[model samples]
Target chain A: MKVELTLFGQLADIAGRTKFQLQDIPDTDTLQKKIHEMYPEMANMSYSIAVNKKTIHENTVFEGDANVALLPPFSGG
Target chain B: MSERKIKNIFSQGPIPATFIAESIQKHSSQTAIGGHSIFLGQVRADETEQGKVKAIDYTAFEEMALEKMHQIREEIFAKYPITCMHVHHSLGQVQAGEICLFVFSSSAHRKAAIDSCNEIVERIKAELPIWGKEIMENDSHQWKVNK
Candidate 1:
């Protein structure tokens, strides 16, 4: 399965792209591990994982064709 | 209660003063609204160790931000007796001294409008999934976190 991944703020700068498709991801837990493997620097930052626009703290099974976003702490005014 | 429709709260670049003026003008006919409270967020230029901050470039998970904002709006309306509320935030680059956020709330009395407006501003800062990159004059940058 494939999922659309979005990187925001500093994460986007580190990842070098805002949006992309990652393949062969079975669940969010595994997808997170793969992301950490690809971007080691991301491990140091505190971020929340959102699958299909809702933040999930626990391991969640990807429903497939979902949009995943790595969001850092909000700073909007 | 019926679900309120989510609004597009984003505007590209800085928010213009004329737009704000027009919004205020549009409310003149609402005689029932005796009080209006407004909050305007302006980008501040701060001197950092690397250089002076020049502007802020904002980004967001648009789908989620709008969803979260709508939830907050619903909660505020349920809690307060405000007549109406409006919230707008800037995306892309906003230069220093330019407006980035506009929150306006109106009510029959002053207290509800003031309190709800304040709460909405705080909620937007803490809850919205928006990110900002502070660009320095010397081309350096850092991620902004609400304090």
Candidate 2:
């Protein structure tokens, strides 16, 4: 299934774009691996995956289209 | 008391001092509130290996931040006997020495207001998804990580 991938902060800088479409991404684990494969630099950074606004801690299988965001470390005051 | 709804806690740029003063002035009629505590976070011009930091350009996953802030607000209110609280954060570039965050809490007593204000600031620092890119004097930038 195609998923909407959003990158924030330094992750966006690394990705060079804020949003993209990941076609045929199967599950959260695969999605992570696919992203790392696509952007090896991302493998060195720490980030969280929020699917449809809720952070995912465990491996979750994606069934349909979802809004996925790769959020880097927060620095807000 | 009326039900408090989730508010948009972001401002486009640096929060003005006048706005903060006006907020305090508007609360004068709230006779029940005997104490108020506020926390303002300012951008610091820290020296880096490259050069001195000039400003911080902040960005966020705003939808998630707002939702998390709402939850934090409810949690703080439940934990303290405060009258009300307000949290505002800057979105774009905030120069060094400018206000980037404004947290205000009021209560019938000083202790509750002070404690709640502190808690909110800590929580926002630890939990919010806002990110800052520190721009240096030479115009180079680095991503900031909260300690």
Candidate 3:
């Protein structure tokens, strides 16, 4: 399965874009695992995952209709 | 309950103190409160760990920030005996020594007002989808948060 990932804040700068796609991830957990595998530098970064703007933790069953975003800690007032 | 008035978010330059003062004036009443407390978060140019912070570039996921602000207002109202509350935060680039956020709360006593002000500011800092870039004099920058 393929999933779209949206990055924000410092992560967006690191990734060099606001949005991208990941293909062939079997599940949410694998998607996360694969992301770390591809970008080992992100291993130490704290970030949150949102499926369609709602934060989710653990394994989320992606149905291909949801938009996933990786959000770093917000520092603005 | 009185009507909700004034803006909770701004995308321009420095936040005017009059906005906060006006909000307090509109809601102040001898019957409703005897004390009011406010917390104003000023942007500082000095970055303790990363050297001098020249300025801060503030940005927000506006849709989410507003939703979170409304939720915070509701929570604060429910948690305290406050008669009124106002929260305004700056958006876009703000230089050091400028106001970033202004929170005001009025209650029957001083303690609750102070406590409410602190809580609201804390929650806003922790949960809101706003980001700040700490720009140094050398042009190097980092996200403005203690990790």
Candidate 3, superposed: residue stretches over 4 Å from native: A23-26, B1-10, B28-31, B48-50
Candidate 2 Cα outliers beyond 4 Å, as residue runs: B1-3
Where model 1 places Cα greater than 4 Å from the true spot, the runs are: B1-3
User: C-alpha displacement of B122 in model 1, angstroms?
Assistant: 0.6
Q: Give per-residue CA lDDT, model 2, range B22-72, as digits (tens).
A: 999999999999999999999999998878999999999999999899989
* Residue pairs with clashing backbones, model 1: none
CA error at residue B51 for candidate 2, angstroms: 1.2
All candidates: interface RMSD: 0.7, 0.6, 1.2
lDDT of 1 by residue, B1-147 (tens): 546899999989999999999999999999999999999999999898878999999988888999999999999999999999999999999999999999999999999999999999999999999988899999999988788
- lDDT (10s digit) by residue, model 3, range B1-147: 425532457557677767767776776455768888888888787755657887788777677677677778877888999877777888877778888888888898898899999999889888888888888888888888834
**Quick one: best TM-score, which candidate?**
2
Candidate 1, residue B15: the lDDT equals 93
Q: How many angstroms is residue B111 displaced in model 2 relative to the true structure, after the best TM-score fit?
A: 0.7
Candidate 1 global lDDT: 0.93
Highest lDDT, which number?
2
Given candidate 2, what's the lDDT at residue B116? 96
lDDT values of the candidates?
0.93, 0.93, 0.78
Per residue, candidate 1 scores C-alpha lDDT tens digits across A7-69 of: 888888899999999998889889889999999999899999999889998998876678899
Clash count list over all predictions: 0, 0, 0
